[model samples]
Structure formats: structure tokens, C-alpha cells
Target: MGDTNIVGGIVKILETPEHKTFSANISVTKFRVQFPQFRNTSVVHLTFWGNLARYVADFYKINDYILIEGYISLRTKRISSKVISKSKKIEITVFKVYPLLLS
Candidate 1:
């Protein structure tokens, strides 16, 4: 099991949550929450899965301040094909969430 981490920030962009079905008809809810950084205000994407995903999607809206508890992962993807460059994209999978400062 990976270590649990928590992050709190104002909701930058609250995209619509979606329901997806995998093999064997296993269903899961997925959503991305983009929050800003402290200094530069760069956005970070947080993923929510399962029941918590539904709750977050139903309750939270843009500009709402929320605290997220989850696991962090780095995804390496090719950023430029001509330049042969790769970049690490930071992703957080949220397991639990707390309402810090609702708006």
C-alpha cells in the first residue's frame, strides 16, 4: 500500500464527474479537481474514485475550498515528439476529502 497524503486548496476547475465501466462491468466514478499552487498558482489535478467520487462530484463546486486525502503518483509522458522530451505529470488519487472553507 502507498502512503497517504493530504492537500488543501481552493477548487480551481471542477469538471463534470463521469461514470465508467471496466471489464466485467465493474463501475467506478471518476473526476478531476484542479487546484492552484500557493505561489505561482499552477494547477494540480486530483482524481477521485468510487463512492467518494460521487460525493465530491455532487457536493463540491468551483472555488470551493476542500481538503483532499489521497496518494500521489507521477506519470511520465512524452511532451514533445520532435524534441524527444518527456515530462512528469503529478497526479493525486483522492480517497477521502474534508471541507475546509466552503464557498
Candidate 2:
């Protein structure tokens, strides 16, 4: 097994018809874990893979609290802008996710 970077935060699962091929886009809102010098709320995007992918997608729901443990992956996707040109962005890929109790 490889060493994975863990990021924990609130779950924000996004589902779109186009993403039916693999799995729904999973995201974490207000991700506070970051570098020592950086203090900001960030969003983390996670892509489930293989058999475990379905489990994570099915079990987790929007607004659920979760702790994700996985390697940090950087992805660049093109986005359309109204007044600006094309843009590329980065995201995180989660391999493991666990639900946390509110209490």
C-alpha cells in the first residue's frame, strides 16, 4: 500500500447525469485543513475508483459529516467563462471516506 494524505471535512456530494459512467462528483465544503501559513476555506473534490467507489457514493449523502483519507491529486479541467478566456483548475481525489457523528 502507498502512503496517502488525509483531508477531513463536511461532505458535499454533487450528482450530474453526465457523470454516470464512473461516479458522482464528491466534494467537501469549507475544508479547513491546510498549510500553516494558509488560512482559508477551500473545497475538496474526490473521485471514487473501482469497487469501493460505489460504496462511498451510495453511503454518503449531502450534509453528512465525513473524514476522508486519501492521496492528494491535482487535476486541471477547462471551464467556460462569460467575459474571460478558458481556465484550468485543480482538485483532490479521495480514496477513503468515513462518516462522523455530530455529537
Candidate 3:
């Protein structure tokens, strides 16, 4: 468990939500959201699963502002083969989402 809640605009829907069936036909939907940092305008990544993923895919689009409640996770992935380099990324797993209506 982590303490992380984020409010930002949707920069890009990296991938549309899709349902995948695992062993025994257990299903889940997953998608990604990109937002910007408040202070420096840097980008952040978010992942939504199950119902939240479906909702986000149906209602959200690029450049839409939204408030998300979730936990942050630090992920490390191998990015290079020649040099054996790795990259660290921060991702948020969303539990709730709200569209920010602007007038």
C-alpha cells in the first residue's frame, strides 16, 4: 500500500483498455494515462486496472484534466542490451478517477 493521489491533465492515452483472460478465463482490463507534473510540467505515468481502466477508456481522452486516487510504484525495467542498462519509472495504479470539469 502507498499514499499517492494525483490531479493532472491527461496528456495521452498510451493504450486503450483491453480485456485479457488469464488462466481459468479470469479477465482484467488495463490501460495507461500520462499527466504532467504540477511544478515543472514534467510527465507522469499511470496505470488503471479492471473497472477503473474501463471507465477511463470510455470517458477520458487526450488532454482531459482528471483527478486520480491511487498508489505509486517504482518500476525498473531493462532498457538496453548492449550496455546492460536499466531505467527506473514511477507509475500510479489508480483506484478512483474523476473528470475535472472546467468552465
lDDT of 2 by residue, 4-65 (tens): 55554545443320123324454322222222223434445566565456565556554555
**Per-residue alpha-carbon lDDT of model 3 for 1-103, expressed as tens digits?**
9565554344444454555656854445555555654434444567776666666666766556677777777676544543334766667777777777422
lDDT of 3 at 71: 70
TM-score of model 1 relative to the true fold? 0.63
Q: Estimate each model's TM-score.
A: 0.63, 0.52, 0.59
User: Distance from true position, residue 17, model 1, in Å?
Assistant: 4.6
Selected candidate, larger TM-score, 1 vs 3: 1
Cα lDDT listed for each candidate: 0.63, 0.48, 0.59
Q: Which portions of model 3 miss their true places by more than 4 Å?
A: 1-41, 79-86
**Best-matching candidate per lDDT:** 1
Evaluated at residue 34, the lDDT of candidate 3 is: 59
Candidate 2 whole-model C-alpha lDDT, 0 to 1? 0.48
lDDT by residue for model 1 (1-103), tens:
8665555444554555565656865455555555555544455567776667667767777667777767777766554553334766667777778887766
The count of residue-pair clashes in candidate 2 stands at 0
In angstroms, what RMSD does candidate 2 have relative to the true structure? 7.3
